[model samples]
Target: MDAVKQHQQEEYQQFIKDKIPKPNLLRNAVAAFVVGGLICDVGQFISNFGQSYFNLNKDDTSAFTAIVLVFLGALLTGLGIYDQIGRFAGAGSVVPITGFANSIVSPAMEFKREGYVLGVGAKMFIIAGPVLVYGFSSSVALGILYLLFSI
Candidate 1:
């Protein structure tokens, strides 16, 4: 009886495995690499533009680049293009500042119909809140440590 049950379980496992779609590992890797590289290249272009056109200093250029990238990401999300990109590039679309913007905007957009105060405002941070909390807390902790060690 036990042997029969084990055989049935193995057959079920094999049946489930066969039903699952196989992923194209090589294709996905190449797409992610290309898409991620393109996103970085766009960021570099923004940085260069800030430096050359705006004559921003190094720190300001960096800040300006981040702002522009985030804005573009949110704009694309609003326009629904980011979702398409996300589908095609998968993780590639998620390795940049734009992805962070998308993370904030996507939820807000999805919940907008529930009202501004409760829906957009509240749900807007659902995904990013924990990340922001952890990030800020760690930064503060690091800063305190640095201050203590320096003094």
Candidate 2:
């Protein structure tokens, strides 16, 4: 076990060395922080617009934001727009519900050449299904736990 661990560590170190050279740490840090913040900023902008324009409260606004983003993601996936955005933004394109939509649809779209029954139809929900299942289950479990603890 110790030998295996040491070998793995060495391999990881070599991988890192090959991929990323020692650089200006400050510049990388600033660029990462700025880009990540910009992505979140866009998400917040959507939420705010939903709240103000749709007369939604915060909770409703967030839901509206996610739904709209997911819809846009699906549309972009259909139109092949999301791929370009993903390339440009990297984490920026992937930090929202839009990313989730893309993950689900992209696979099915790729497999569509295999025919609907065996391809798109069958595989359409493969990615999103697990996410939906876990999301709902965790929410329910948390709700129950909160209710039990509160009482």
By lDDT, the best candidate is 1
**Per-model CA lDDT versus the true structure:** 0.93, 0.80
Which residue pairs of candidate 1 clash?
Answer: none
Candidate 1 on 1-151: residue-level lDDT in tens?
6999999999999989978988888888888889988999999999999999999999999999999999999999999999899888877888788988999999999999999999999899998888899999999999999999999
TM-score to native of every candidate shown: 0.83, 0.64
Q: On a 0 to 1 TM-score scale, where does candidate 2 land against the true structure?
A: 0.64
lDDT of 2 by residue, 1-151 (tens): 6999999999999889868867666765555466557656767888889878888997898788788777878899899988887766665566567878898889888889999899998888787788889999999999999999999
Index of the highest-TM-score prediction? 1
lDDT of 1: 0.93
lDDT at 80, model 1:
97
Off by over 4 Å in 2: 1-36
Question: Cα lDDT of model 2 overall?
Answer: 0.80
Lowest lDDT block of 10, candidate 2 = 27-36
Give the Å shift of residue 105 in candidate 1.
Answer: 0.9
